[model samples]
Target: MLWVKAFHVIFVISWFAGLCYLPRIFVNLAMEQDGAAYQRLLLMSGKLLRFMSPLSILAVAFGIWTWWFYSFASGPGWHWIHAKLLLVVFLVGYHHVCMRLHKNFVAGRNTKSHTWYRWFNEIPVVLLAGIVILVIVKPF
Candidate 1:
């Protein structure tokens, strides 16, 4: 079980690393004007999104393992877990939105400004803080 927890943390960190970096990539993608730069960023974002997908799956899988193995879902002081799951669902949605935005960028149809992406980039950061607090404090 400790091994499960350790791997869960590891994969969660991996997923969060991608989540943290991808939006900054979007920020660059949004701001880039040069054709060559655009192509370069497109390649970069595509590769990154691909790389992150499996990490997200592994993180969620390990989370499920932790929940099932530890039975944390049925335990007291776990309302925060429920909330954290909800936040994670939103985080997954955010991930898909990033994919869609990538598609839009690929199609040359992106309408959003770099400022919008800058704001969008903060979503995961805020969620990370919320999730960490919920897990550590287990605030009801």
Candidate 2:
């Protein structure tokens, strides 16, 4: 169980690295006027998304394993776990949105400004803060 929790934290940190960075790449993509630079940023973002996908999967798997063991073995008053899970679901949805936005960029159909992506890039930070607080403090 300790191993599981450790791996969960490891992978979550890895996944969050990409989640926090890909959008910064998008910010450059949005601002880039040079064709070569735009294409380069697109390649970087695509590769990053691919690399992080497995990390995200592993994180979720370990998280679920930990959650199952702790929630059931301990029994009751795990509302904080439930809330953290909800935030995780939203985080996953945010990842999906990033993928969609990447696709839009690939298609040369992105309509959002760099400012929008700058704001978007802050999302995972907020989610991560919430998750960490829930896990550490278990605030009801």
Tens digit of per-residue lDDT, candidate 2, span 17-99: 99999999999999997698999999999999999999999999999898788654343667787788889999999999999
Tell me the tens digit of each residue's lDDT in model 1 across 1-140: 99988999999999999888988888998888769989999999999999999999999999999999766686677788899998999999999999999999999898999999999999999999999999999998
Q: Provide the lowest-lDDT 10-residue window in model 2.
A: 70-79
In model 1, which range of ten residues has the least summed lDDT? Answer: 69-78
Kindly report which residue stretches of model 1 are placed more than 4 angstroms away from their true locations once superposed. none
Clashes of 2: 0
| Candidate with best lDDT | 2
Cα lDDT, model 2, residue 139: 75
Quantify all predictions' global Cα lDDT against the true fold. 0.91, 0.93
State the lDDT at 50 in candidate 1.
97
Q: Report RMSD (Å) for each prediction in the order shown.
A: 1.1, 1.4
